[model samples]
Target chain A: MRYFLELAYRGTHYHGWQRQPNGISVQEVLENALSTILREPTALVGSGRTDTGVHAGQQFAHFDTDLTLPDTLIRSLNGMTPSDIAVYDCFPVAPDDHARFTATYRYYQYQLCRRKDPFRADLAYQFVFPLDVPRMNEAAALLLKHTDFESFSKVKTDVKTFNCRIDVAYWEQHPNGDLTFHVRADRFLRGMVRALVGTLLAVGQGRLSVADFGSIIDARDRKRAGRAAPAEGLSLVGVGYPDSVFTQRTTGPAQAF
Target chain B: MRYFLELAYRGTHYHGWQRQPNGISVQEVLENALSTILREPTALVGSGRTDTGVHAGQQFAHFDTDLTLPDTLIRSLNGMTPSDIAVYDCFPVAPDDHARFTATYRYYQYQLCRRKDPFRADLAYQFVFPLDVPRMNEAAALLLKHTDFESFSKVKTDVKTFNCRIDVAYWEQHPNGDLTFHVRADRFLRGMVRALVGTLLAVGQGRLSVADFGSIIDARDRKRAGRAAPAEGLSLVGVGYPDSVFTQRTTGPAQAF
Candidate 1:
């Protein structure tokens, strides 16, 4: 049987979403907790990888097991996991449903703090300079018109193509004077979201014009883009999956015990 | 001359606001930072003390210094302090101005999470059970009618009186479905806010009626109230002082260098 686990994590303590030899990762911790609760060696695959210090508001993982699952699995797993990580739900899914490949869309957010906030020091990027938000929005609209994002992708990524269908991309100024960049797309290349935010910030700072931003996208070279924004300010906010994958919706609300 | 420093801190890492014999405290950190920057042994007094694991959005402290004030003191102090603590302003005040005695009002907020949130694991108190906000507010209004809070105060305290002038007390529900208890008063008893919140939560959960809450206050006994709510959910959000204290306001916008 295949099961899908819904979870969220504050990524400050982990190396990233994927397992690594040098430092602990969210995947390793989740796997250990699941294995301990089930009394068997369990391995699961995450929906995608998030960089170090990046948070995930919603993430999915899938695991295969032969033993009958316990009714107290969720509670037991939560007890075994650290406070920074939480498992909200566990439900059966079709054997063919893949956590990574079956997802239809991904949504991400980048937080920018206009003022120095001690509470959000680790959760947002502080940029005190005055920003031209309307001008930044005009440049962000240029994202939806482009299909190939090679210029905004990491240079050494292993993906086969740099083409991504962007559905939504805009910057919203919050009432507290902070800024949040909301972007949704069919898929994303390595380091794409942060790169886009960095470039848009340049536009907001009047360092680059809308025409210059569009020309950089047309250039199709990663070197033409600005530096990648810090990982702490980025979060994987949501992911979309098909309804056919679920045999039955048995998960509860996203709350910790 | 005496100077007033406006600051904020995330109290998860500190023992409490006051210096302790065993653990690190916010007061100790600030004093050390001041001593390092001024190159003299400097000791400051805080507006009030916050329990361990509590947060402060805005706090004030007054320190006496004989040496000429440095222009880069704010930046230097921030550099010496950790990321969780922030100093927003430092200005000369009247020599007689005291951080604790002269303040006219103090405002506090207690956060309650309706659902389990991974991002706010340490910042809010999670109560999955249903709550009656209107009922809680009604119980809170009873607070403003009373002057003595001995029933909600810690038994062993150095204070001579338990009477507090409550200006405002109310519970507000945010759009995200979280509840916040806002209270402002001329003074507060040790553990008073948490005790009030815990007992009011009982009213919200139907465990106690509004009249029962009032009777708890009228009893004037410490054992009559519910257990004090956990410290993590509470924050000292604001403090009000008279306008006569400032010699010259020379503070910039609150932003970390």
Candidate 2:
């Protein structure tokens, strides 16, 4: 039977979400713990790969096993995994359910701190410049107009198209003067969200106008876009799947051990 | 000139706030950075020490220097310090100003998560237990009634007295089901706040009644109280001092700089 595993991890120490030939990755850590706990070798297919130093508020993966999952499986896996990685839940899924392809929507948040914050240094990008939120949002609306985002996509990739359905794009200014960019789409390219954020920031800084941003998107050239923002500020905040695929609550309610 | 520096640090990497014999400490790091930036030897007297794995939202220390204070001191010190240690501000103070003795209030916050949260795993303690908030508050209210808290003090301390003036004590539950305990006092003994939290949690769990908690304090024995909560969950949130000693704002207002 196939099982879906919901998890979250701080990607600072890991090379990335996917297994790598050189450095350790989140997948290797999860698989090692799952295998050790189950007494059998295990393989996990993640919903998507997050770059090194990025973080995930929520992520999903899938693995198959013949043994019935014990009640203590999640707890045991958490104990074996490193402190930065947390496995929240594991439940059965349909045989053909794909952790990656079955996801309908993806949400990402990029944190930008205007001032120096010791607590947020690892989790946010410290940009010490004034930003025009309204102007940035004006440029944000232009993102949904174009289906092809080659200007924001990574230069080297093996993909048939640079098309993605962007449902939401906006900028929020927090009370602490920090800024957060919220972006939701059906899918994203290799470096799409970071690139988009970088370009929008330029617009907010008055370096580029909304019309210039639109023209850059229409150019369909990576060189026309702004530099990709730092990876540490980006996080995969949410992933949506069909209701039928989730057989049980992703996690149980609070209770005493 | 004597300068009071307001700073914050994530204590996950250092041994603690004070200089230690063997391991690296926050004080050592700050001193090194300040000396390097100022091009002279320096010593800092912190308001107090924090244990290993504990965090500080706002902490203060005083240092003396013969050189004229520069406008770029904050930025230069920040560049010299590690990312986890943030120098927010530095200003001149009265000759006899004390960072520890003159402070009238210190506030601490203890975060307890009812469910698993990967983002907060390092920042909070995951207590998978149902807590009776009202009962915990009842126990918390009892904290301000007494001053001699010898029951919660670490045994080997060299302090003259265990008396503390607790100004505020309360437990607040967030919408996400997380519980946070806020405690403000004129002074605190080593391990006192964590010990109070642990004992109150026992009261919430029904292991100890509110009356039992009061008795534990009355006993004045180190073993009477529950075990001190983990260090990671506790943080020094704020420190208050006389208006006369503060020549400038301890922290600056929110701005995009």
Instruction: Find the candidate with the highest DockQ and give its number.
Output: 2
Best by lDDT: 1
Pairs of colliding residues, candidate 2 = none
lDDT of model 1, residue B4: 91
Q: Chain B, model 1, TM-score against the native?
A: 0.97
TM-score of 2: 0.94
Please state the Cα-based DockQ of model 1 relative to the true two-chain complex. Answer: 0.49
> In model 2, which runs have C-alpha deviations exceeding 4 angstroms?
A247-257, B250-257
Is model 1 an incorrect, acceptable, medium or high docking prediction? acceptable
Quote the positional error of residue A208 for candidate 1 in Å. Answer: 3.9
TM-score, candidate number 1 = 0.90
Cα RMSD, each candidate:
3.2, 2.9
Task: Please give, for residues A29-90, the per-residue lDDT of candidate 2 as tens digits.
Answer: 99998998889999999999899888988888999999988899988988888778887778
